[model samples]
Target: METRIDEIGPGIYRLSTYVADIAPPAGFTFNQFLLLGDEPLLFHTGLRRMFPGIHAAMARVMDPARLRWITFGHVEADECGAMNEWLRVAPQAQVAHGRTGCFVSLNDLADRAPRPLADGETIDLGNGKRVSYLDTPHVPHGWEAGLFFEESSGTLLCGDLFTQLGNGSTLTDGDIVGPAIAAEDMFRSSSLNPNMGATIRRLADLQPQRLALMHGPSFEGDAAAALMALAADYDQRLKAA
Candidate 1:
């Protein structure tokens, strides 16, 4: 397991861990995003077992204990499995997620209460950086699934939307659409929700410059066009299935 941290956006850092020889043929990558600001928010805590690595990675840049907000798109183990562990280290930090996630899981599981945000609510990270929450139910997987977009950086902290196979790289401008479609075919991780297309289009309309993914690598390119391509492919794939 090799863990590293790299700056993707201006002050946004991506903490990634690559696990070779996973069940999949291409291996896997677990990523977490840390944005430096007045409040200092961290998106996705990776798996609970990766806490030490994640902690060590953050220590290289900033104090992990000083993090104020621990947020995620959904309630999956890879997403919030380490919520309590993070709250244990950062006493001042609060668990944050979409209202659905908080009501469905975090309210009962988390050691600390969660700051639930409405569909369009925004959380100020200070230093002119703020995150606007988008309630994307079952777009990728979870019923409480949602995502966040940074206003200053135009980066969408999209969780599992464009999941690619293999531990590719830190970021890429090439075609991830093909790899993501292949993964979707193999894993069937995407949802069968009727509103899936609408949800995808919503994220595309945001016109994100960077996509902070959880699995595989991050992306820097025309997110809207990529999203549209995925949406169209997904529809065709679903029909074939």
Candidate 2:
């Protein structure tokens, strides 16, 4: 698979999966990430089917076998389907889980130990770059979820948050590619599931500049305000209901 990579910010690139032709649901197609750091971190694996693209994208930064950490928010296939592959390629890479629950679940799946991460945990990516974990369980789906904010660049690696439909070339919230529409669609999808609103509240309080979605472009601007809008809107809906 020939993946299209776009540099969304310094050291960050949006990797477009070649499988868009197969028509995956929103937040389920590809991955957006930063790879030029000393110890690069990948937020999500596109899918089992997109491992080739994922692999190729990683190779662009270094040998696919050299990544130090493979971090993920959830245990879903789209988020972690390529775990075995990553373990195969990057033998020394540790699987970073947002919570102890996630570490246990993933251990059961891959028969490999996981590096448990909690809120406020920080992984040094070297060269003054580090990604801090912010636990936000059940935002889109519950199962030990969290977001990573790259301290050096101020980019929030939000998983399954601020996602949208369509496979566009540019990937960022400030790209005029439809942040409000995407935010509403994301709210609607997550609202159908219980417990996600709590995560939204946490995100509102933990503000970041960029909201990088796995399936679509990253959302930029005042992330705190954007997240507050989401949290407030969701709260109002629940009250009305």
Summarize candidate 1's per-residue lDDT along 1-241 as a digit string, tens digits.
6569999989899999887776456788889999999899999988889989999999999998899999987888888888899999998999888888889898999998999999889989899899999999888988999999998999999888888778777889988888888888788888876677778888899999998988867889998998889888877766766
What is the C-alpha RMSD, rounded to one decimal, of candidate 1?
1.1
Candidate 2 residue runs with Cα over 4 Å from true position: 18-29, 173-188, 191-198
TM-score (all chains, Cα) for each model: 0.97, 0.84
- Model 2's number of clashes is 2
Candidate 2, residues 1-241, lDDT tens digits: the string is 5676777778777777645444345333466475566777777766777788767866776676667788877778888888878888787787888665555587677646878887899999887788888876666555576778887677778777666566654644454324544555545655333455666767666657777778666667788777766666556656766
TM-score of 2: 0.84
* lDDT over C-alpha atoms for residue 128 of model 1: 89
User: lDDT of candidate 2 vs native?
Assistant: 0.69
Candidate 2 minimal-lDDT segment of 10 residues: 20-29
User: What's every prediction's RMSD, in angstroms?
Assistant: 1.1, 3.2
Clash totals for all models, in order?
Answer: 0, 2
Candidate 1: clashing pairs of residues: none
